[model samples]
Target: MLKVTPNPPVTEPASITDPTSPYECPDSKKFNEAAERALDYYLGPPTARIMAAPYCPNRLYMTNPKSSNESLLVDASETLGSANVMLNDFAALLEGTHRKTLLGIAQIVMLGELAVNQVLDNLVPTE
Candidate 1:
């Protein structure tokens, strides 16, 4: 006969004995900081079934670009995914009812690029 295992009870304060690991409670800034993880939790992750998350959720792209199917390119896929999805078809989403968490990731990348440019600009100008 096959045996089934029962799940352990969850504890309020996580410790070695607790079934779940301790995690920081949601904070006001968590949305901006952990958008991707939040989206993965909600949208059930972009597995082989879902493909990729939008890289530019803010833009109304006619078509998105494709990235390599690799873990290293997961962040890159988010932006290209946005370009791939038809913006016209998701007018309601564009109106801003749903959170564009994936696009937020792309925006973060843009911000990082700006920072890098500033650093490079400073270095090149210095003799």
Candidate 2:
């Protein structure tokens, strides 16, 4: 009877047992240094090296650093008041949970405005 399958091809064993095999390096120190350099290049430093950007205020709408605290407080109060009014108007146009949420925010803004107004009232005018 004839065989359907052909005989397997013969092959040489791997050179792992040889002293100069590609698996073994003659200069281990150099190899280790190269590997470390490669790892450092790919993975970066062990510690974080993040560089923070220097603070530079926007020139277009930057607040004056020399502005009086009272003036700043007044501005803040006016902003909060406007925000509250806007929130109330928006809440009036909505219903359900969204309206309730907006109303709650408006109440908070109104409270903040009240606090600022109280501070303004307590502030003594400087000569």
Best by TM-score: 2
lDDT of 1: 0.50
Once fitted onto the true fold, the runs of candidate 1 whose alpha carbons sit more than 4 angstroms away are: 1-99
Q: Candidate 2's residue-wise lDDT over 62-106, tens digit each?
A: 789899988989999999999999999999999999999999999
- Clash-forming residue pairs, model 2: none
Task: For each candidate in the order shown, give its overall lDDT on alpha carbons.
Answer: 0.50, 0.82
RMSD for each model, in Å, please? Answer: 23.2, 15.2
Q: Highest lDDT: give the candidate number.
A: 2
lDDT score of residue 117 within candidate 2: 90
